[model samples]
Target: MSETTTAESAERRVRRRQSRRELIVLAAVEVFREMGLEKATLEAVGERVGLSKASLYYYVRSKEELLGHVVVHVVRAQEEALARVLDAGGPEERLRAFCHSHVRIICTDPVGRVSAQVALSGIRDDVVRRPLHEYMSRLESILRDGVAAGVFRDMDLRIAQHSIIATLNAVPLWFSPEGRLSLDEVAAQVSGLLVDGMLAKR
Candidate 1:
């Protein structure tokens, strides 16, 4: 009984620690996004989460580390969102879902906004760069599948993928949640244009 209780206590501690780390990461994302990474400070992030500078250190080692965590988190989210569409949708449907995913990532998610805003191509860490590479590959896989299925055009898949991503990434530059056009409206419009352009001729 004591062993079981001890194990449960340890598990709770781990869960709490993980929960706190995630909260701090979220706070860090907001700080970095608002202030831009080079200008963002640990003190600001800690204040957002109600933690002191010293206490924030317990959760994250540095601003760079927080950015890394945000990168990994953002990419993982993008992959998982696409994975769900890839699993059960047809080419057209999957492409539409991808549009929604793209919009949500850039416009709705704070971490994702930061990821898109930052010059991630400058990041050299393999751990950070690895997921981004996989993300690009997944995007190409979607394009390739669409082409093979006779849904997408026969043009260079790389160009198509890059164009789609570049257009979507530009959303946050001018997108406003408080604007007249809602997020869904933007996604639908983009998805229609991109997907319809790729449709196989009747």
Candidate 2:
């Protein structure tokens, strides 16, 4: 085969593999969300996708491995979203933008919320913990930068970071699309509160 043909074939193969992986992940998400992480089983997940237990094992070795896949997806998505906000004009804008996106994801991405909750206890190794730490550390750094730039008040950076993430993570508990407040409206309100509260006083 020609080089161009080989390249095209490789691209197609990768796309096919990604599609299959997404199917499995989606099934896992639905099962895990309905059953909760502690109760999520490979058999149930496989049944959700109409795959046999053995078949599911081919894709994922264990519950922890499946959790890792889900966590990676959530971490990467949030990272990409936050990266955009980091590039915004100023510290205030960046922080507000990050809050807006964070809230949006919490409301819409069930797996993302589960990933955060499960990461606390689901994974037991330093290898998994390190990436999770880095992801959160980035968010804390953003808050610290805002404070240093006189956009946010001089407060305990770790406390501020915890408050921000805690607020965002709570959305899955009370958020309802059919509720009075829309996601955008909720995000705006949350962002406003955080920004106004953190603004440096003249």
Candidate 3:
């Protein structure tokens, strides 16, 4: 086959692989959320996805791999949110956009939130842990950049990142569409506090 055809074929194969992976991950998310990490059974996920337990093993090597996939998916979503912030206008705008995007993802995707909490402890593989830690590091980098730019107040980036993420991560626990505050409203409140705390003192 020609080089162009080969490249196209490769791209198609990648898409197919990604699609199958997504399906498995989605099913795993439901299973994990319902059962929690320690109790989640591969057989349950197989049933959810309409596959026999043995058949599901073809896609996922073990329950641990499924846990990894779910956590990795959440990490990827946060990374995408950070990329969106990079395209935003100024420090304030970027911070607000990041908060909004982050909160929306966490609250709306409960399964993702649960996966983020449970997967780290449950996975014994460095292959999974390293990437998750790196993705988390990106959040601190954003805060540090804002501080250096004089838009955000000088504070320990580690504490700030942890405090902010911990608060936002809890959104999945109590957030409700019918509740008093909308997602955007909660995000704005969080952004206000973070920005105000980080603003240069007059």
Q: Choose the strongest candidate by lDDT.
A: 1
lDDT of 1 by residue, 1-202 (tens): 6999999999999999889998988888878868877789999999999998888898888776777777678778877888876677777888888878877887878778887665333666565556566667777887888889887777688788777776777788887889988998987887788888878787
Give candidate 2 misplaced runs (Cα > 4 Å). Answer: 1-15, 83-85, 116-131
lDDT tens readout by residue for model 3, 14-133: 898788879988978877778877888999988998989778887888877776777688778877777856675877677677777777776778656765565335456765566566
On lDDT, who's better, 1 or 3? Answer: 1
- Residue 78 of model 1: what lDDT? 75
Which scores greater on TM-score, model 1 or model 3? 3
Off by over 4 Å in 3: 1-14, 79-85, 119-128
Q: Which candidate is the best by TM-score?
A: 3
Candidate 2 backbone collisions, by pair: none
Off by over 4 Å in 1: 50-55, 75-88, 119-127, 177-180, 200-202
Q: For candidate 3, give the lDDT of residue 51.
A: 89
Looking at model 3, residue 94 earns an lDDT score of 71
Q: Count the backbone clashes (under 3 Å) in each candidate.
A: 0, 0, 1
lDDT of 3: 0.75
